[model samples]
Target chain A: MTQHTTGAYDEELRDLVSRIAEMGGLAEGLVSEAVTGLARIDIARAQNVIFNDHRLDDMQRQVEERAISVIARRQPVARDLREIIAALRVSSDLERVGDLAKNIAKRVIAIDGQFHTKRLAFGVEHISEITLEQLKAVLDAYTSQDLDAAHAVRSRDDEIDAMYTSLFRELLTYMMEDPRNITFCTHLLFCAKNIERIGDHATNIAETIHFMITGEYLQEDRPKQDESSYIPAGYSSE
Target chain B: MTQHTTGAYDEELRDLVSRIAEMGGLAEGLVSEAVTGLARIDIARAQNVIFNDHRLDDMQRQVEERAISVIARRQPVARDLREIIAALRVSSDLERVGDLAKNIAKRVIAIDGQFHTKRLAFGVEHISEITLEQLKAVLDAYTSQDLDAAHAVRSRDDEIDAMYTSLFRELLTYMMEDPRNITFCTHLLFCAKNIERIGDHATNIAETIHFMITGEYLQEDRPKQDESSYIPAGYSSE
Candidate 1:
């Protein structure tokens, strides 16, 4: 009788984990679409990201419902219970990360095709690419339950933030140099900030993974490292 | 035997709701203090908000952990399960609201006392007061499971958004009028946007409450109204 119950519980937990991974995949897709939409300034793609947000919201609900159902039916203890709870929190964060990405895309659309002019200088594009890579890594870390990868994602957040701050200062200079640039530069600044925030949400997912493993929160706060990289459009920060 | 088991399940579910209420109070306090810190441009208070963010994060984890534990131990179904999931989602939203508020305070300190010169004609003092009240109302609506109160909160969010939009336009004008105002106006704009985001988070909680009672998501995405002047300074919005 004991063996039968334990076997049933293991199967249920595995089912729960599988459902979580499926939800994570959907979430990662939303972030990717939203960012790609922003980069290409594709209003259709951006609108697609906005419309698809509801699907993620629905998936979040489904994931939580499944987790709760499994918990109630299976009565998991210790590690399995923590894993399900982490999945629940992760889905929530992932949903918000999707929302933030949508916000960026919306801003991209609202700016009315202005980013196309005067091109990005001072590594904005590189920073965005790195932020996207970091987001992908953290999602990978969570779905795979990798603490080392999670830690690496956490460490990289500061670099994205610093790059963003440098971008902010540069944009401010543009707005200052030509008041006509206010509308466009400010929009880009907010877009960069949105990408930075997406990185923070990714860091959040990693921290949750660390907590699930260690049963403790990671202690270090992400730092704000500033940079003064203002050469020409052709010059790289390196 | 069935009667006794159901009765025990009911009591455990009640306990989950009560714990969620407790966490809600803590989150509300964090948002209140964070905005108050921004109003004063108090660096120490701002730092405190950031430092205490972990507590909000921990509380969120605790809420989900306990909710899941109850589910495992009790095996609740239907409404009982829905209530627990609602608590989980609401707590996550509250934590995000706290993070947004802390971000506002961080912007406050980043401005470093130059804020007074560029104060929006709309006034931070006024917006701060309304925002705190909105936070409180949303928490009350959640804990009490009052859908009417929740709807009312939802209605007010549009107002908050409109106020933030107005502030956004004003800040653009200020930044265009004088380059020196860029840093100061940017910080204030961030603070305004943070407050606006809190209103959205509060609305999310209200929607969750509505969902818990009805099992349906909010269908209408109404235009955000202007709820900023609902209460005169030194009075109440009610």
Candidate 2:
């Protein structure tokens, strides 16, 4: 291959990476805004998050097409091929992150001023803060191909899972306390689950980053502690 | 390209398709068993579903690696390239379907013989039946590259959404009637949701099939009718 050909190939790869970066940024912003809107009960901001998801979708389509084109043109083997596959997988994960965020935004509109509980809102905010941080760190790991950072994000997901389990218990107690609270708490529970799923997506990207660097899957089982739905022994029905 | 070269390429493509088909079959079976386990409260069947999910994950990894290897060796362009990309996307969707089924299986163990309402179980069975049908139809469409069949699957998602909304309302009513039913009904709600999300994944595959055949996205917005979360107007708090 000529020097000029190699230069053009490198340039195309850079463009693909930049597009993924842009999509990642959009996804991160959407999750943050959706959680904020939920916390503040701000309909307009939630609406904004919902409306902006189309952009992430469009960017994902673009990245996919460009990646395919590069593969066809370059016929890149080994590491280059792995990198392209990683980009494709990461883009899909980010697009899903956008959809989960949109689901949370939709819940905000659904709740619609029926009830407000400060402590419950605090629980959601705390979980969202940790999830957002994990997403940011994972995206950075992908950009830098930092294996250790990616492993760190993967290890830390149990924190989000544990938090989600506690929130689930609290919401269930809230609902059991009063029938009127049932509808409101149900929506909050879904919102919290969406956040938890977003954390899972972040962990997925972390694994993808690890694979991209090593061409091997993370050998250990994903650490998970979420057991909120489990029923305890000897709990008698009223 | 020589006839031998073309023959080898076709063989490789066939192998890839067959792997996807195998994964699809496994995912379909898992959904069926998980829902049946829930309906019958059979712990063994539910545990079987949980155990089977790892196979789908392994199949997905194999599909991805094979697809990347094919692209590197063949540099397939245009339709061939699209087909490989479609395979990757479909495998991912099937893997997620497997995860959602595992989630239902987990919920089966969680409810733990506390309460078993026949009517609620019937509702879940009904929704799972429809979603399983959709998955079957979409997989068939992908295998045959039948655009019309794919579009039909995409159009039928609204039916699942409507069913989910009714189930949500029914479950809430049960919870309100007896506080003792709260724990059972909440777990049922999550199970119903996992089925609804499986429907969404089927729709996603339908769209992917359409793209593989036509190289264009379905232009219309996805039809949605889930409004159970919406707070009703003029509802006074008790």
Candidate 3:
């Protein structure tokens, strides 16, 4: 009889965990669908993404409110409180991710079926894939409370930044090569940049998770500057 | 003798307010210089903006830290505490404003003596003017604590957004006209978007000031949708 009761309790815990996972999944879906909508130049799909964003917003608020109530009612402590707070922040980030996606979709619709340079489009696609991968990795890290995994994901964001830099240079070259390339390439640049920012936000989520697990802030390190040069004064970074 | 002491204290307060205003002026100078640097494609000017940003950052931190020390030592209450905290947030926002200026300068350097198409160039110049006006208006609002002035600044942000949207469309059109326009216009777009975002952060500062004085958030009211509107279930704004 005791074994039966313990099994039931485990199932309940699993169910709650699954619900959080489902919410994450939905948020991810929203971003992907929005990106796909842009790439395909599917206005209807883009509009759908915009229209459906309210649901994600509502979902995020709901998850946070429910978590808060559960904490208050049960007076959760230790690991339970940590988990609840992490879930709360994760949902919030997810909602922001949705907004970024919506912003891109809105831009795509504004373009009104115009295709920018194919190269620029391809660059955005690459960035989108990298961003989605980061999001997935962070979600996995949060679910498992794996700090090492989260740190790894955080470092990977630098790679995305590097890519963004290279893409920016390439797009600049394209516009210079043909003065006419300014119009379409600019939108492509924004789209790629939006993806890069989304990646940054995902990194932020991972950092928050790392903080929840360990009291230390992950952003404590100063931005890397060349050591061979004289360091600038008055900008004391910890 | 009592009146003399009160007068001296008032003079000290006036000095503090002047210092805050001076910092605000410095922030405006940085942003304007950054924009001018881009228009002229002046690498040296852009580098100067970047180099000087550290000073702004340091001053911001010092101001906030000193404000906290003053509150702790003086045991300020009510309006005094509110004013100090308001200064704290404003300083932080000013630092971010500096960072945004640095970001713009970085874009200018990234362009590396190259110029974008005239159309793209004009787009950035227009947006920069609009952003500068917003920055000026926000600073004035901060100094005066005029809620209506702040609100007017906030409303003007939509105009900035609209200009940004137009710029985005123009850039997209250029890129679509030729794949080669992708490179240079991409950089210009970054510069333009950075200015637009700075306007947004300035608006956020205005909102924070409004909140500090009135203790009410100024966000637009959430719209209620029908049950069939696909709103996330189980969540209420409450």
lDDT ranking, best first: 2, 1, 3
Give the per-residue lDDT of model 1 (tens digit) for A44-147: 88788778877767777777777777765666666777777787878777777777666766765665544334464334556768877887888788767899
Misplaced by over 4 Å in model 1 are A1-26, A113-118, A121-123, A214-216, A220-238, B1-19, B42-54, B115-118, B121-125, B220-238
Model 3, B185-230: lDDT tens digits are 5556567767877887678678757865675557532222111112
lDDT of 3 by residue, A22-99 (tens): 767876887798788767767798798888877777776567446544543444444544555566657767877887
Query: What's the TM-score of chain B for every model shown?
Result: 0.85, 0.93, 0.83
lDDT of 2 by residue, B79-161 (tens): 78888899999999999999999988888887656666656678989999999999999999988889999999999999999
All models: lDDT? 0.69, 0.84, 0.66
Residue A85 displacement in candidate 1 (angstroms): 1.7
For every model shown, the clashing-pair count is 5, 0, 25
Q: Which residue pairs come into collision in candidate 1?
A: B158-B224, B158-B225, B159-B225, B159-B226, B159-B227
Per residue, candidate 1 scores C-alpha lDDT tens digits across B1-238 of 1233567677877776787777778777777777767666667887887788777777777787777678667666666767888888887887788777667766656665443463553455566677778878977887777899999988887677776766677677776676667666666766776777777888888888898888776864556433321211112112
lDDT of 2 by residue, A35-145 (tens): 989888889999999899989888888888889888878888877778888888899899999988998888888766666564666788899999999999999998888
Clashing pairs in 2: none
Q: Name the best candidate (by TM-score).
A: 2
- In angstroms, the error of model 2 at B165 is 1.7
Docking quality level of the chain pair in candidate 1: incorrect
